[model samples]
Target: MHFDGSTWWMFYDGTSRGRRHVGLATSADGRSFTRHPRNPLVLDAGAVDVQRVGGVWVMLRESGTGTLWSTSPDGLCWVDRGRLFGLSGASTDRFGQVTPHLQVVDGVPSAIWFGGASVVSWNRNRIAVAYPDGAPAPAGSGCTACVSAGLSCAAACQSALGATGGACGMPGSTDGSRCCACAPEGCERCIGASADCHAACVSAGAAGGWCATPGSTDGSRCCACW
Candidate 1:
């Protein structure tokens, strides 16, 4: 939810027949919100985080397949930009990356989310953070890693994969691990460790095959198979 001077905007998700849909509502007093005429902005998407970036409205949503991003000129009409990041292979986020929230501080942007081994189990979940660009925070500043060699999850990611950010540890136990995003050259997006890239491409029967990118077009840590 965001407040733009006179109005408060809320983005929420609802389920119909087990499918998720993203919707928008607005209110002047931040209490009684009315759904927008164009409700359900996107299908099979939820956990939306909306913000204004460079005078344009940017929305990030968690699609079942992956996290997707879109851009809107008037905040009503949007154009899909495809997957942002998906399941990292780490124990903390192996099964899911849920409830993504974006925070911008002093012109720097970071994304935080819950990582869990089971999509339905919240008690064993852990909080994860990512910088995407690998800037500002020195490696291994926050969370701990499950890896060996005394390397924090973030540090290990940076050292081994040149990852921008990573986090580790869980709320109740020390079993949780961290996931990192590494944007490789030429790739437009990054595939999470758990994503079945080969199977997805094969199922889609893409004729152009796929390629990997070193960095994300939007400055996020990403690798793409296009």
Candidate 2:
């Protein structure tokens, strides 16, 4: 499905026999959709939703492990991004299927779960936002409002500078409105410049951008445009 901030759309295979691959459809209302083609839009994947991200691909396909166990620019591709962290291990499903958990807080994507084999070795479902020292704290518990959402106000401020062509490590914060305009890194814009950034933290035509990211100031970790 595609979410342009207002409408939700998708490509699905209607209920039938031997139905393989994707089909196109659009919806003004999320439930009912108009199918574009009766045949598969893109075929040859093992499962219907082998893997997919909302707004990053023309179609979906499941490649292999180590391909992208985590988030990347597009939900389909993963590579060198400015952000990196110590992923202790894949967060697993309660039944032990290795289904990790991910969420987007504020505007940054964060993974929260017990390092199963770590010191505590907890065996229960858990959800919390990240902390400055890389610890996990309950949501709404962080250095600032944005921090509670998994993004530091400093990163938010840096976003403001980047949007305006300022350099890193400078006093660049989102303008008075907390808008992190999509500009060059270390870029300098007015203190209150607007964040023309996509809801997922990238520009329209830039290379390597996150699409429909997780986490929100509202406490719902959904895949957002930024």
The prediction achieving the highest lDDT against the true structure is: 1
lDDT of 1 by residue, 1-226 (tens): 8788999988888999999888899999999999999888877777788877767787876534445688898788889998777765554455566667667656445554434332333333456655565554433423333444334565455456654335553422344333333333344244444222332233444322233334444323232323
- TM-score for each model: 0.57, 0.27
Please state the error at residue 203 of candidate 2 in Å: 53
lDDT of each: 0.58, 0.34
- lDDT per residue for candidate 2 within 1-226, as digits (tens), equals 5655675656454435654545566677788877764445444332223223443332222222211132334422433222223332333211221222334355444442222211111223223222335546544422343322444444445443433122223234323344332234221121124232222223323222221222223312222332
Give the C-alpha lDDT of model 1: 0.58
